[model samples]
Target: MQAFIKEPSKHSHAPDPDRLHIIRLKNEIKLRGTSSAEAPSTILFDVLRSTPLTAAFGLPTNDALLQTISRERPAIQLDHHVRLPLILRQTDRGESFILYEVDSMVIFTCDKNLSGLVFVPVGDVLKAYSSLVNDFDDEDYLLLDYFERV
Candidate 1:
């Protein structure tokens, strides 16, 4: 009789930890049947606080602003065929701004007046969401150029 010992494979196909986290988040959202679950806010805050944009650009997190955000669920909008859940708020300076989640990881902030857009990536956020918008094809050249500059 011959006995054979099986060795473990050198290649592992496990998903990346960040990707796994996103998958779990999506599952949780699906299970809840609405994106308004506790997960979205928690995930949003987690991403916001950790992003370099917040630290470097002085992203507002004051209690009043946060309270306004928590007061109501954001309205989802379809822009250029992309569905984006947006929280529209008036800044302290009376400027209208929109904060929308991108790719379930990063949040993109845009000025309602088409001033500029800021891309804030959460921890290990992916760029896969760009494909959904088709690179903002419906936007004007100046706006597209502004995005390119950002």
Candidate 2:
């Protein structure tokens, strides 16, 4: 599958010091370009940038993915008994998701950094983020995607 990314418009004369972030769905046919004349050869997300190959992952060996997720979400405090997928979304207010990490229900996080990851125990803030991400399983989650700043 082919993948491309488009960054949000607006030159940051001073940009957002808050760290704007978004999620890009891979494997989705939506990112495979289109099958028509005049169609672009690449697909892109206005909020995502093409990631460097070296940044995809250090190496997919011995719990590499899990280790990475843990590194990004050390505060989630997950357990083996909790087996549910958490969908991560980007928001103007911050980062968000629904998962077994905080028991149940979706969580809207303002930050994913070690000190910035805050859990919204209950609220309607995350529902408004419906347009930000496609549903995804939590068997494995990405920590580097947009969570990492340039």
Candidate 3:
């Protein structure tokens, strides 16, 4: 496995080690990696770092601004049934009448490769491409852009 350098610690402001932002939450407050149940850390890391969603928006999100999903549940049974929606929004306009936000951004890098800075909320990304005809028949971006800018 290749070594990836971690970004400068930004969670230093938080005095509690458990409160550190190792990974932004997704639904039930999952860290970027997995829990004690997961046996292989390598596979867990790959699934997160390689996902196109991360590639586009970058994973282990930046310290400056992070898209928070939510907190984890202490109860395993209750957590198992819960599902959170991922919403993505794009504010930038480009040549492509219809642009999939994921295609525009690159994965986040701890090693200082800021290749792509764009990120999309999971729900929005799915919604934008859900219709998928490829032509900008209607203004899909009407309300979407605001989610990213503000």
Candidate 4:
């Protein structure tokens, strides 16, 4: 009788550790590339950096802000479940500003890159936008700019 030889399996059922490592590295690289291109980190970093609004506008700590939000939840006008970031443009001068609302306080950055942070109570959001524009306006800027959430 001839001896029969068993053939080797074409594929392994178990995952290869090296292959898994390669996949992880590829995912990390893709994430890093996109993050740098969109530069969303600036906003995220600023959000953390400006915690408690950094008291830049005499605002209370994050805990205190949350308390205030709960207290004034009824009056606050938020269309969405969460207040998204906003980009406001000056009507007259054509300057742009970015806004992020944390609880009842709104954080403002004069430039999109978020070079500086300024904040105001949610109630004064519109006025805050106008104030920034007026700061650079050659003439008195009577017109107000509206918030366009991004």
**How many clashes show up per model?**
0, 3, 13, 0
The superposed Cα distance between candidate 3 and the true structure at residue 141, in angstroms, equals 59
Candidate 1, 1-150: lDDT as tens digits: 999998768976764445544444334434433445464456455544544442433333444334444544445565684644233344545544445545455443446434223454665233533543354435445664565668
lDDT of 4 by residue, 118-144 (tens): 667889877776656645444433332
Per-candidate TM-score against the hidden true structure: 0.20, 0.14, 0.16, 0.18
User: Is candidate 1 or 2 superior in TM-score?
Assistant: 1
User: lDDT of each structure?
Assistant: 0.46, 0.35, 0.36, 0.44
Model 1 worst lDDT run, 10 consecutive residues: 53-62
Model 3 segments beyond 4 Å from truth?
A: 1-36, 39-44, 53-56, 60-70, 73-150
Indicate the worst ten consecutive residues by lDDT in candidate 4. Answer: 141-150
User: Candidate 4: where are CA atoms >4 Å away?
Assistant: 1-77, 82-96, 112-135, 140-150
Q: In candidate 2, residue 33 scores what lDDT?
A: 29
Candidate 4 Cα deviation (angstroms), residue 28 = 64
Q: Please provide, for model 3 over 96-132, each residue's C-alpha lDDT reduced to its tens digit, 9 standing for 90 to 100.
A: 2223224345332221112122365776675554433
Q: Between which residue pairs do clashes occur in model 2?
A: 6-45, 6-46, 85-138
* Winning model by lDDT: 1
